[model samples]
Target: MATVTLKVEGMSCNHCKEAVEGSLKKLPGVKSAVVDLDAKTATVTYEEGAVSVDQMKKAVEDQGYDVV
Candidate 1:
């Protein structure tokens, strides 16, 4: 497994946190996703070969957030 911390932007509340976390959790290899609204970041743990950072970024983007 591998873990990554992505700097995310434009999250303002608990709903935003849930949105980001929920989106990441939907990915096939994702083991867990936690979003920090105050820090504006998302930390994700997943099976390394099963998912890519780009795919995770896209999932977050698809939910209207920016992954920097």
Candidate 2:
């Protein structure tokens, strides 16, 4: 598995955290996702060839957050 840590912006509560995590977990290769609201980042573990970091970023963005 490959892990990607993304700097995210505009996450302020548990709802935001859950939204981001849920979005990432829906991806086919994603093994796990953790969003830290205080640190404003997301750490995702996924199958390397099955998913791309760019796709992960898009997932977060699609949930109405910015992936920096």
Candidate 3:
């Protein structure tokens, strides 16, 4: 598995964290996700051959947040 850690913007609370995690977890090959509100970042573990950083960015943006 590969880990993608992306900085996320506009997340203000735990609810935001949940939304971000939920979106990322739904993508194919995603194994796990952990959102850190304090750092404004998300670390996602996914199958190396099945996912990419761009897809992870989309996952974050799809839930109404910006990936930095």
- What are the per-residue Cα lDDT tens digits for candidate 1 across 1-68? 99999999999999999999999999999999999888899999999999999999999999999888
Candidate 3 global lDDT: 0.92
Sorting all predicted structures by TM-score, with the top scorer first, yields: 2, 1, 3
Candidate 3 residue spans exceeding 4 A from truth: none
Q: What is the RMSD of candidate 2?
A: 0.5
Q: For residues 25-53, could you state the per-residue lDDT of candidate 2 as single tens digits?
A: 99999999999888999999999999999
lDDT of 1 at 17: 92
**How big is the positional error of residue 25 in model 1, measured in Å on the Cα after superposition?**
0.2
Instruction: Extract clashing residue pairs from model 2.
Output: none
lDDT of each: 0.95, 0.95, 0.92
Cα lDDT of model 3 by residue, 1-68, tens digit: 88988999999999999999999999899999999999999999999878878988998998899998
Model 1 sits at a Cα RMSD from the real structure of: 0.5
Stretches off by above 4 angstroms in model 2 are none
